[model samples]
Target: MRPTGPLATIRNRAAAVAYPVFYRLPRGLRRWLVRRVAPTYTVGAVVLLYDIDQAGDRTGQLLLLRQPGNRGWSLPAGLLDRGERPIDGAARELAEETGVELTTGQLTPATPNAVIHHHGRWVDVVFEAQAPATETTLRVDGAEVHDAAWHPLADLPPLSRATARLLAHYGISSPHTPLDPQPTSGQPDQPGPA
Candidate 1:
């Protein structure tokens, strides 16, 4: 049974006081404290799905998803649940985000583990798989993914930095040129008042 009423109130009050002090510490110190308190780590996987067109001389296209609120597109990815294997997590995230399902054996590691610091440290495993030449439909969760599409190897939409790096690592060249820096006012460049 769960605690409630006065007991819950007491627990909440304790947490309210403890969390403020905990957050004030430096990130390294806070991570250390959390490690001492409990075993915790963030791990995730990114999946790259390539579509091959057998009829079109087996040309390759890459799948990318546009996330809501994010300017650049990214591969389907998500964090692993407690005790989940990286390969399993990759397959699961791919299915959840893009409705494309794959067995673990079908997925292959594309890069060494990548560690990134965003809200906190994250370790990501990258995987790649080829979609059947006949497969064409793609489905995305409306809330998290605004759009999903496959682009030819030489032609891709604006991509997130990580996606661009991954493509380069795989020896795939992006056809989209980088955009020029825009002014803060969100307008075309203009000379100062004459």
Candidate 2:
């Protein structure tokens, strides 16, 4: 039987009241509860905008943003809205975070969907596009992104794990290497006093 009139109104009101409370819980708990209640999964997209320098040995520079909340440097990314296509979501997130508008046709798939498991399982669709090296002006949304800059494929700051993995998948190595673990002196390693 269809819920009509007061019954429907009561159900709607109950959901409205419950949703905020549910959202306030820690992300892990919220996802756990949601999974128990329904089949819940999230889809996201990350956009890697590259500028190919035809004159500079045909090198490419990739755009990255320093996101707020210590998320580290990442490509512009966000969760897709319901009923939205992955390409469309990529375009939307790119425009929203970087103020760079792109048509859906311009983006090419960078990798197969990357499944990330954390508090919630996420399937991230990655996309990349080539932009003019000199023409594009990048403006970051201050609330989410603190800064935006383009780095050559060989030089990059500390990257978020997902971003690092993406670059590794593409076989691109960043110039920012970790300090060597070996001591400069050729001495036997000694353990600290317990």
Candidate 3:
């Protein structure tokens, strides 16, 4: 949720006046201003799609994607398209980032459906959805997303800061720091000592 009361009113009013001015600036100057002067306010949806591990009798793993913008794995996330609801946005992003298709009805708001101002510049609408572990398939387009996979909640590849914060919000501790995941014994990527 966005800030409310007097501060929000002021910010909204400022944006109202600024939008036209911002758009009118020359493209190069606009780009420079974006980097130096203003922080873009964006609303997006992030999903923690867990596997329903019936045999293990617990939530199996989380679906993560390797996006061009992130240095490491990130949860399925995208900015809400014009006039889109948060849940529907989440469903769309999940389908686009990973090949998994989920209906809005299948998504459970993570503890609460309220907007989360997560790490970095995200105003996120977060959801937790589940599907059968073995039946789910993953695909990446290679243009925007390079990889997609289900990873154990405890043991994860290096994660984006936003992903780590979202997991930590649920009390799931991430072993590695956001940018670099430390090699753990038995993990497929863990390198043997030289």
Candidate 4:
């Protein structure tokens, strides 16, 4: 039998608050429900940063891509090459998407946890960085990315929810308005793959 003490009660409460409502079901059912909520997923690594020189007092720009697959704006991100380290993958993605080499000293893990998706299959390990705001040029891969640009923190085009959450962690807010006390939880207008 399970322990029935104050500790157990607190544990139960914490579990309820941290997980979905259906977590109380049988193990198999609970797992099935959770999987059903976020079925398709793949892993990727990402980089974030601000260029201090060219990007003055404004919050640093996030590197973004207009990809053919999603045909929408997203963080400068890509899937990890098999057997690659997360940080290495992040740096590789940064270079591939923007032509900016993220030296070992410049990369940091923003989120090690998997970025889940109920709609698509993409799990990304995000990295954060801050660099001098210089006029860095971009050379994008047309097959994967049609366009690349530095988006001011305030005026991001519709992007992924996971990408937005990562930005919020750095104290940035919506580009369309002044900073709100709470970050937005709603979806942006970009359409996902059909």
Candidate 5:
């Protein structure tokens, strides 16, 4: 076989531990290694909260949070807390960003995606959630989020490119608004998935 060495000894000992045998090394270590190698494994989540109208019609509007950095517009999202359930994190983020309390049923895990750089490197576990069909007053914290609103689906201004892709996958569309035609940026303009 190979020559015995300190590194080899540590590796052999690590392999004997329950963590290594059962779940492999702890996920934190694995993620740390991944981040060190790729620098893109920093994880977070985005919650899409759609407000429905009385007729059971999805109003083609979604709750968005205006963050301190991207002070104009963005989907409600945040970094996952240690040991936090993804659904809980999503709901918490929705409430924290938009001050709307949504039950767990209103949230579901979405596909994982990556953002190369917005403020820094990040990976996102996006989720879709339905806001209750009732109107709730929004109280935004001016530090983290200065504004929160239900934006018409068809009229989203420039948001993160990654979020735009997620919207397309969900077949969401903005209701036709009477506002003047705005020039389309380089990104996709199709309504969200049906």
Candidate 6:
């Protein structure tokens, strides 16, 4: 139950005055308290690993990972570990899913900053990187990621909900892009689920 009337005002004022004292606590305790009291949401990073077919030519081919189970095809994405930077998270996920390693500077932000859901629950931070199509070698573990392939923008396989939405936000402009059916407007969707 929430405090009401004078009690609510008192609680707010107390918290405001105690703000400095709160910072004196250990970092781990502070994080734990925040998680216990604050709303929960995930911060994920996704990468559009584009390939250049010819020298200085954009091929429109991007790497997609075929994750095991019902995830279908999706981009290189994963939730950021606690306190991980977005670019570092993107690079880590890309290297983990596909055997392509890239420096954080090699990736560029694809969205305005991060793509937040309408319900303001989860965020998908997008990044784009380019590599030579012929020179890029992809290796998947065949378990976490069943396959890794470079798919042209004109032809794409059935995509997971997160991938579909992120692509649209990145200006794919494909009306026929098959987006998964969402449960409802009020419900927040997972950026990527196993």
Candidate closest to the true structure, highest lDDT: 6
- The TM-scores, one per candidate, come to 0.63, 0.65, 0.66, 0.59, 0.60, 0.74
Evaluated with TM-score, which candidate comes out highest? 6
Q: Which tens-of-lDDT digit does each residue in 1-194 have in candidate 1? A: 77889989999999999999989999999988888887444678888788866554435778888887666777888888889998999999998988888999989988654533332335567787888536667788799888888877777877765556545545665556353454454322321100
Off by over 4 Å in 6: 1-34, 118-120, 173-177, 180-194
Q: What is candidate 5's lDDT per residue for 98-176, written digit by digit as tens? A: 7788787867776433222323345556677765446677778889888787877778755544455445546553332
lDDT of each: 0.71, 0.71, 0.73, 0.64, 0.63, 0.78
Winner by TM-score between candidate 3 and candidate 2: 3
Task: List the candidate numbers ranked by TM-score, top first.
Answer: 6, 3, 2, 1, 5, 4
RMSD of 5: 9.7
Positional deviation of residue 175's Cα in model 6 after best superposition, in angstroms: 6.8
Model 6 per-residue lDDT tens digits across residues 56-84: 57888878888876455788988899999
Off by over 4 Å in 5: 1-40, 111-121, 132-134, 165-168, 171-194
Better of 2 and 4 by lDDT: 2
- Lowest lDDT sum, 10 consecutive residues, model 1, at 185-194
Candidate 3 error regions (>4 Å)? 1-40, 55-57, 118-121, 178-194
* Residue clash pairs of candidate 5: 153-174, 154-174, 170-193, 171-192, 171-193, 171-194, 172-191, 172-192, 172-193, 173-192
What is candidate 6's TM-score against the reference?
A: 0.74
> RMSD, each candidate, Å?
14.3, 14.6, 10.4, 8.4, 9.7, 4.9
| Tens digits of lDDT, candidate 4, 1-194 | 99899999999998888677566578998878778886555677777756566535435576677776552466777787889987888888878877787685778766544444433445567677766545677788788778877777667776554455545555654553332343243322222321
**Best of the two (1, 3) by lDDT:** 3
- The number of residue pairs in model 3 that clash at the backbone is 0
What are the clash counts of all predictions, listed in order? Answer: 0, 0, 0, 12, 10, 0
Model 1, residue 73: what's the lDDT?
78
**Which residue pairs come into collision in candidate 1?**
none
